[model samples]
Target: MTSTHSRARRAGFAAFVGTTIEWYDFYVYATAAALVFGPLFFPSDDPLAETAAAFATFAVAFLVRPLGGIVFGHIGDKLGRRVSLVITLLLMGVATVLVGCLPTYADIGIAAPILLIALRALQGLAVGGEWGGAVLMSVEHAPEKSKTFYGGFTQLGNPAGALLASGVFAIMSRGGETFIIDGGWRIPFIASIVLIGVGLWVRYRVEESPVFASKVEGRKQSMPLAFALRANWLPILLGIGLLPISTGGYYLATTFATAYATGETVALSEQLILDAMTVASFVEFLVTLPIAWLGDRWGRKNIMYIGLVTSVLTFAPFLLVMPGRIEPAVFLLASLVRVAMSATYAPIAAILAQMFRPQARYTSIALAYGVGAAVWAGFSPWFATQLIAWTGSVWSVIAMFTGMAVLAGICTRLAPQHSDEAPVTASFTPRTDTRTNRLP
Candidate 1:
């Protein structure tokens, strides 16, 4: 028992650290896209067109995520989770550093945005593979009763990264928009190299997942992706359906909101939005573990339902109040919405992991999350921008947000749970018998 607890702690910490760095690298690009990428990379006469183009470059990463999942997921299912994760960290770090070094449109014209897209694509690929392995490393190592709690550690990386990214930008924006637009953004990207070194060292210190070693080490799947598609398609689809809030909704609240708040519609300062996001991220980070513990006690799906419902309710007010430029209201609403989001996001790692058997869990989860991100997260900001551009109202965005939350809630209720460990009472029960290892 002592040894198991110790191992779980080590794995959870390593997963948290690795994912935090990956997310930090990813969110920095998101921050830049909302703030500086338009003028710097994709220069345009119309501000809206420039913003749309910048978001398009941001979306490029999501396009390649499925491929990254396939490539690295295969490596994870066959070689080991630890091996794949280390490679992803290195890939993400190198790409981020290169982004910091790239010349802007003023310097290189079309080649500049083209190179930016390429680097962002690389980032998408790395993060595409990064999430599943990190979640599995923590959850698979945890004792059965504590799996959700440990899995929450993996989820922690999201807000922690967001907090770090937003906080860094908030500090830098103190130098003013002139400073940020000129060169302040590059510091975060270049500094990712140091984080990559730290992540590599921490990830190396953790052992391979005992689940993989015991069940899969000797007999590797020849084609994990094909196997996942054939046997795990239902769960994969359900997983995708269940992630609208965690994926698209999150970007809507942070990335799109930042741009909208700072754009002509709201005309708030960039620093204000960044500061609000930083506060929200910090609040979400603080509450994530407690919410995950609640999921363990009350039920994973129950907690998710609560989050989904509240997100819709809170989001409407946030949209309405944001346009008013009320500083205190903006700060309060941002944090409140993030707390609601954390309830939805924190328990999902374990829920998704348990939805598939060990044979191709890495590929299954990665593909589900990657494709979902591509459709929901990758395109959401751009879509919301276009919707506002066309309809001339933020309420269109509110309608879209509500629809996503509803979809995710339905999927969460229906998704099957399959695990090698003891069954979680609150999670969805599989209709098919566990003894036969078959899905309904």
Candidate 2:
């Protein structure tokens, strides 16, 4: 390959790897909250309330994500994607390591949970910034010929991160509950420091987004959120409305599956849940890359329509089959549920990022997409688990998933096609960058 091609490819891969590490730090906490934190951190006599509290803490992180997205989104739009990328990785890595070192309720009374909340909030903030920065790094640097494919490549980090987190937790859990509760959990959280160093090194070598660089040169407004809101409220709102189904399905397959299988009287083995997650992550990553390629050719909305329809038809049956079973058949079914999620996820970054001008692209996409995705995806596992417990039927969760699919489908139908959307591609011009104020 030519030197230029090689450099871009390496840059894209580096961005992808950084995304994997950032997500690994994020998902490990979610996994622990699902299985172990209720017992270890909360230490309550009432099992139900304890589980609820744990999920509440898990959900609290997402509540902070919108703010994170707005904050980092402004920095990215003004300072450049590279700067935002470095800040987010360091923030996530430090928070994760701190979580590893936190004391449990048994050791510090109520202070333990309070400290845990603070750390998790930091994590939420870091992740809020991470997605927008990573997506922009890959897609902005990507060539015009393969925009969707390269964009999806960055998103592939989500599954890779999930695989690492699940694989590590699985290996650690084998040492038995006592081992996991006592110290095994710390191993995964502690691993983030090395990952962060590697991510920082990779990100530092990449140049600023071509789009942002040019926007600066053209005397564009520095305040991206204001520019986005004033110019593109319709698409922003639509993007927000469209994300619940994609994220809701993700939580159902990963977080809720573990809880429903383990938290109930008929709890399945932790090993089984981890194995299923590993396989699902593998399949989703493999499938997402190719589907994103198709999205570039066939149109993102068209592919999304197919996915949403499939989800609407399959949601009820999938959830119905998930509980009271733990075999190869159920495993295959679970993996397919994840595949459906991957279909929507693969093209979403590019599609959403396409909605605004280059100057405001970062903030518009991050706040609208990031905030919506976190609220829908982050809280989903907890919501599904609670719904299952309250209704005593997996069908209720399935119904919820199906409803979200329909909602996303409607929004997808309304979205402007890529050719119709304004361009966000980077330019060669140079100018001063402006930092925007944070969104409310």
Candidate 3:
């Protein structure tokens, strides 16, 4: 027991570190898209058009994430979670570093944006495979009673990565807009190679998930993807339904908000918005584990209910406060929304992990999240920008945010939970299903 607990801790820490690095690479791209990618790669006469174009390239990664999930999910379910993760980290790191090295529009004209889109697609693929394996590494290794808490460790990476990305950009912006626009944005992308090295070292040292080792090792499926689709299709859809606040709403709050706050409408300084985001990420990081711990006692679904509702309530106020240009209010509201969202985000690792049995859990979870992220996170910033562009009001965005929150809440209620160790049952019921068998 003592050795198992120690191993679990090690695995959890490794999951946290690996995901933090991956998400840092991801968030740095998001931060750059909001800040410099527009003028640097996709020059435009209209500032909004430039931002929209940058966000379109940002969306490209997301569109390809589902394919990444399919490819890497196969490796994770067949080869090993550790093997898949190591490859993904290396792929993501190389792409991000190359992004930093690429020439801009001034240097290469149309090819610059094209190259940017290609790298972003690579990032999407890596990340599509990343979340499921990381979550399983932490949650599957966890003691049964503490799965949500250990899973929270994986959740910590999001805010930690966001904090690192936003904090670095915030510091870079202190050198003034010209400094960041001229060259500073590339530093974060290039610096990610160092984090990739550290993540690789940690991931290599950690043991493979015990669930995979004990239950899934010898009895490999002929085709994990086909098996998952045939058996876990409902859960996959439910998983996608449950992730709106975590995926789409999250980007709307952070990436889109950053650009919106600094846009012509709000007219706030870039530094101010970045600083607000930095503080909010820090606050979310502090609260995520505690909230995940609460999910154990309070019921993961109930905790998510609170988060989904709060997201609906707080998001409108967040937008309202931004236009006021009250610095303190902006910081407070942004942090508040993030805190609400954390409840929806943290327990998700365990929730999603438990949705499918260990047979093809990797592929199932990856597909769900990859598709959700592609649809939600990928287009959200651009969608929100277009919403404001068309309606000339933040209310349009608020309606979209509210809709996402509600959808998540409904799906949370509908999604079934399964224990990987539970005995296989012979049934295919949707809501009351508790089967954990490898399908024949």
**Candidate 2 lowest-lDDT run of ten:** 431-440
Give the 10-residue window scoring lowest on summed lDDT in candidate 3: 431-440
CA error at residue 417 for candidate 1, angstroms: 0.9
Instruction: Indicate whether candidate 1 or candidate 2 has the larger TM-score.
Output: 1
Give one digit per residue, the lDDT tens place, for model 3 in 1-440. Answer: 78877888999999999999999999999999998899899898999999999999989989999998999999999998999999999999999999999999999899999999999999999999999999999998987667888899999999999999999999998997599998988899999989999999999999899988887877768799998999999999999999988999999999999999989889999989999999999999999999999877777777888899898888899998887789999999999999999999998998898888888889999999999999889999999999999999999999999999889988888877777555543432223223221121
Per-candidate clashes come to 0, 3, 0
lDDT of each: 0.90, 0.75, 0.90
Model 1 ranges off by over 4 Å:
422-440
Each candidate structure's TM-score, on Cα atoms with residue i matched to residue i, is 0.96, 0.91, 0.96
Q: Candidate 3: give the clashing pairs.
A: none
lDDT of 1 by residue, 164-223 (tens): 999999999999659988899899999999999999999999999998898777666899
